[model samples]
Target: MFSLMYETPSSWVQDVEALGTLTLLSDHAHCELKAAATMQALVAKNPTCDSIVRTLPRFAMEELEHFEMVEALLRERGGKLAEQDTSPYADGLHKGSRANRKSLLLDRLILSHIIEARSAERFYLLSEHLQDRELAEFFGSLMPSESAHRIMFLRLAEGLFPAEDVQARTAELRQMEADLISNLPFEARIHSGPKQ
Candidate 1:
């Protein structure tokens, strides 16, 4: 987890429509990497938990593949991974245990789902803005997988917590995610280009 001290300007999104596909790829790769590590921890902590453990192997594998694919894309584009500071994007969503163990897991599960769901939504949005034919095609190809990731996380959350609790957690985490995305000072990325 990184600190939330860094912020990017939202206006940088102007160039995203052009570079948006690459941006989507970058975001997806980062998301999967973070997710895989987090899922590994969750599965290890709850080793005997069949549902959680069973899902992690697949998730981890997919994430690794996604990371490689993104790197390949970057290489093809004649670009390397820039040291983009990522603090604002990660904060707030993850609320650890506050004494009660159950609440902690619930919070973790909710945060994970929010991350995946938001990734799916953002990927879909970026896919719409992509211009390059190959990139556009790639983004389109990823939509179903991204949707599946969200569903898997949501189902995992539901399985681990009560229905009401799952609902409440989803609402809470979604708000947190929204706050992070909406309030961040827009920084220019491959997707978030310069403000027009």
Candidate 2:
């Protein structure tokens, strides 16, 4: 299975729904755009292979479209994309990634995978737990792509590195992510810290 690298806490669900930071939806819109940009940057900086150069533009476009859809969702709900701070959860993960230029590409790819997987998992939670029917439906629709992107990132990393190397790094990162989620204080932003 497709178990998440980390399980979101039950209380996080309860807190999000209760605190009414529906702007989390807005945060998601921003995240999709950021994801798209990340891919675009990777494609631009390292055009060594035609496969990514050709494919990443399409993927980036898809992510931008997702951002649009989420924006629409926010507008329909009488909300605007809230100005929020950067997600500590994601910052922590990125901070933990290898900073040396030699391995940076592989590290970035794996980090992107971890972030996408976490988003996919959170979207599933929103779909299952949110009170609004329309919003829940929308959230459910978004999960497949996030999951797909997670797998895509993994494949890209494997293509760049030995399978065993990728696997080991992925496991290390997954454990790091899980521990981070478990230990951090919760917040209302999308990809915020773990529920506490």
Candidate 3:
């Protein structure tokens, strides 16, 4: 049900298994925090966009709540949040975005949609495959919220931009996202490829 061009390799489950639960939870907590920050940043950047202004603060709060939940999970597993490198998956998407002011907002929204969609996909996989029942249930519970966030971003983009423009850009960014996912080295990250 996601709009992703790529399917995460099955090997990712094994990679996560090797990475261990604490490391995965720590990385997941960071992703949730970053998601919250990204939503807030979108609001700040496009204050005049009524749809964005009306919708994103709530979304931001939801992301923050998700972050807190993940943080609690980490602590329960005896892991504390630690510094990790920014996701190359995300950074590559940003680099692929058009820098011109007219395209920037649309691109950013599309990127957010892609990120959320990919996240939901990974969460679904984990929910089904992880041997740890608690973590599996937690990830399963998050799938709907991530999917909703993905749809919301896309709708916001469509509301602000021409339908055709939104479609074309979303398609282009989806391809870019797919390529980035394929190339990134495997790690215990929400958006990562198979270990080389």
Candidate 4:
């Protein structure tokens, strides 16, 4: 059901969405690596507790693999990979989360869940409009994994905070995610773009 190719741009819209999709993938890889690094440092200091830190090293490796896969896909498509700058999509959402430091872990987990959920949504949308059979299939394949990440993050948020608190935080982050999607900063990218 996934293999599809459309010759007409009017029918596919992948010409526009492809750049955005690839850009988002590269950004995801970058952000995942950064997060993993942060967790590593935190874990080292804690040394015995934080289960997250213990698991993060493996997560980081997987993120690197994902980065390579996306990069290879970009190169195969003759699309240039671009460096990531601060995306307005992420910056605005982060600003709101950073402002409230009292519940930092809960905030971070909620925000992370929102980000993953939005990514799954975007991947689904892009897959529907993509033309290349291979590319379409790739995006189609990413949805379930991203959804799983979203759920994991949500569970973390729930553990960190009460149900009511988690719900409120999730709502706030979801709105931020919607805003980020509605207003993207900079033009779309392929894999890597020149530093902005």
Q: Give me the candidate number with maximum lDDT.
A: 3
- Predicted model with the maximum TM-score: 3
Candidate 4 wrongly placed segments (more than 4 Å) = 1-15, 18-49, 99-101, 189-196
What order do candidates take by lDDT, descending?
Answer: 3, 2, 1, 4
Q: Tens digits of per-residue lDDT for model 4 on 24-57?
A: 5566556555545544664565466455555556
Error of 3 at 98 (Å): 3.5
Rank by TM-score, descending? 3, 2, 1, 4
Point out the worst 10-residue segment of candidate 3 by lDDT.
Answer: 96-105
Q: With candidate 4 superimposed using the best TM-score fit, by how many Å does residue 39's alpha carbon deviate from the native? A: 5.6
> How does model 1 fare in lDDT?
0.61
Better by lDDT, candidate 2 or 1: 2
Give the range of the ten consecutive residues with the poorest summed lDDT in model 4.
1-10
lDDT string for model 2 (119-153, tens) is: 88888888888787687788899999989989988
Q: Clashing pairs in model 4? A: 81-191, 81-192, 81-193, 82-191, 82-192, 82-193, 83-193
Candidate 2 clashing pairs? none
Model 3: per-residue Cα lDDT over 1-196, one tens digit each: 6878988866687679778878888888888888989989998998888899899999999988998999998898888998888778878888877543358888889999999999999999999888888898999999999999999999999888999999888888898889889888888878888787
lDDT of each: 0.61, 0.80, 0.87, 0.58
lDDT of 1 at 75: 72
lDDT of 1 by residue, 1-196 (tens): 1111223232232355444445545555665677678888888888988998888788878877877887788778876655545645665344322323457767777666656665555455445654466765665676677678767877887887789988865665665556556654444332222233
User: How accurate locally is residue 12 in candidate 3, as Cα lDDT from 0 to 100?
Assistant: 85
Candidate 3 — what's its lDDT?
Answer: 0.87
Q: What CA RMSD would you report for each candidate?
A: 5.8, 1.9, 1.5, 6.8
- The alpha-carbon deviation from the true structure for residue 139 of candidate 1, after best TM-score superposition, in angstroms, is 1.8
Q: After superposition, how far is residue 43 of candidate 2 from its true place, in Å?
A: 0.7
